[model samples]
Target: MRWFEIALVVLTLLSGLVWLLDKLFLAQRRAAHAGLLDDGRDPWYVDYAKAFFPVLAIVLVLRSFVAEPFRIPSNSMMPTLLTGDFILVNKFAYGLRLPISNAKIVPIGEPERGDVVVFKPPQHPEQDWIKRVIGLPGDTIEYKGNQVFVNGQPFGYERVGDYVGVGSGAEMTGASLLTERIPGRPHQVLEVDRLPFVDQGERGAQVVPAGHYFVMGDNRDRSDDSRFWGFLPEQNIRGKAFLVWLNCDSITNLCKHNFDTSRIGNRIP
Candidate 1:
């Protein structure tokens, strides 16, 4: 959820509490000012809040439990997703869970091998990351010289020629565009020699334990992901990104700003 949504929830709760306190404790003083008898009763603030509290609480419940909107902030999932892509994440698709404290209250389907998932960073729960699931629980993942191996078998790959990333990702122009098979799933990934797989603090392979997943970015060298940090816990999952509502990174196209018609209604894998 965004900061504005967080603020709205906090303010709404505070407002409701204040109104309740005023009605329960200071009702006589408030009613006197409102030209009412000094009998312990509802205050003007309480009356107004009665109508507002339900509406605010409903919004909070629906947004936090039903569905949540998120924007792609980086090129980690590029070729499949780009920067500034506004997407909707199904908050309950994984199962219903209480907001803020992401404890899953219901059981749902687990993430697949090639699924692009959004979750809180294990290194920093405050930070959120989106990436492709490469290794599931109990899977051994190995990345050697740009090749990915899961359970000692290399994920299939096919060269798809050069990738021309527009706007911010233009730096990856002429990078090798390859079709990578993450076991049963196949997706496009970019490999740029100009951008070497510098350790950039990312090192080592991890043996995924039960209820954990190892993720990696499609932009192999550009993203700061599990390779650098670690696996994402099942509880940290937010949802699958499934759309690109809009993309307007450079100001040169402001007047023409709108949905990327080609990307609209596209299913995210």
Candidate 2:
């Protein structure tokens, strides 16, 4: 369980307990002693519980099942999603899961090819990683010469232009930008020139097992994704990223106000 999740649970429970105890036991006592007190002030704990309970509950519900905001920390997504982009992930888009446990209890919808998803990497489950889904369950995926082949058919791509990076993404300038057509969805991807496309030692085609997905970064050569580690388990998926609400550079430094207004309110493709 994450520390933030633990904190939410603890705060919610503590506030609720205080409220209940006050309502059941303390309220009557205060009412009986109402005439004796000068100002008739409520207990500090009761006041605090009353003030915080509703706010905490609302935040917990929204963050755990509705939607949550995440800041992009890397340029692996490049042309699709740049670093410092603050994105909103739809928590219930796939299914509602118990927050910390990540156990999906409801059946909503499964991830489709080309959907941008945030999931815990199989090798490093502690960190959250976002990538575009390239292959679904039971599908064979291949990477050759910087092109992705899904189910024996090569995914089509059209050269858009040369990518000009901005802010934190300036390091990836001059990459080839292309619109990749993945069946129903067409999105932008960045391909660096002269980079190897093989997935470690496992060359040729590989089949995606049930309850798992094949994903890759839009910046093909830069991302350490399923190509390097392994498949993303369905249980580890946090949510589908759908929107970029804000973009701010220097989150760690806090020295400059480098907000990219152009990316605000942009929908994720």
Candidate 3:
């Protein structure tokens, strides 16, 4: 589990325990005494717990079951999602999952082709990664000549002029920007056409096994996606990404100067 998740869970539990113990045992004893010498005051930990328990529980429930905010840290999903874009991932869109364990409690829906999903990649299970679903289970996927071919059929691409990103993303300026029609969803992708279309010795085609998914990034050459680390297991899926709520395009500095509001509140494709 991530450090933030672990810490949040531990703190919430500890505070809740303190609040419960005080209410059941300590509170009554203090009330029985009821003297000027014994003021109606809780211990420091109890006071802190009573004040923060409600807030912490609410946050844990909302973030675990409703939606969670995540910042775009890489250009892998560029043109569609820029670096520093704060996106909301629909937790229940896939299903209700345990916060730290990430075990699905209910199977509400399955991932489809073209859905942008945040999942734990096989390479680094601890880190959360976002990528578009390319091939579903039992389907053949291919990456050749900088184009995606699913089930031996190539998807269509619509040229969308040159990609001119703002803030720190300007480094990828002038890259080929095009709309890739991945069946149901047509989203923009960036490709460096000036360079040769290479797969770095990776296979041109592979069949997605059961309970696994094939995903790729919008920035074809820049993303560290399933194209390199292999298929994403179904258990690793965290949620489906849907909206961009904020944009601050600085990594190290963080909202120091590149906080743009134009992309805020935009629904992700």
Per TM-score, what order, best first?
A: 3, 2, 1
How far in Å is the alpha carbon of 234 misplaced in model 2?
A: 0.3
RMSD (CA, Å), candidate 2 to true, equals 2.0
How would you encode candidate 3's per-residue C-alpha lDDT over 60-79 as one tens digit per residue? Answer: 88988999889888888988
1 or 2: which has the higher lDDT? 2
Off by over 4 Å in 1: 12-51, 200-205, 250-259
User: lDDT of candidate 1?
Assistant: 0.77
Q: Over 4 Å off in model 3, which ranges?
A: 34-36, 197-202, 251-256
True-structure lDDT of candidate 3: 0.88
TM-score (all chains, Cα) for each model: 0.81, 0.93, 0.94
Candidate 1 is scored at a TM of: 0.81
TM-score, prediction 3:
0.94
- What's model 1's lDDT at 29? 66
List, in order, the clash count of every candidate structure.
0, 0, 0
User: For model 3, what is the error of residue 213's alpha carbon versus the real structure, in angstroms, after optimal superposition?
Assistant: 0.6
User: How close to the true structure is residue 161 of candidate 2, measured as C-alpha lDDT?
Assistant: 86
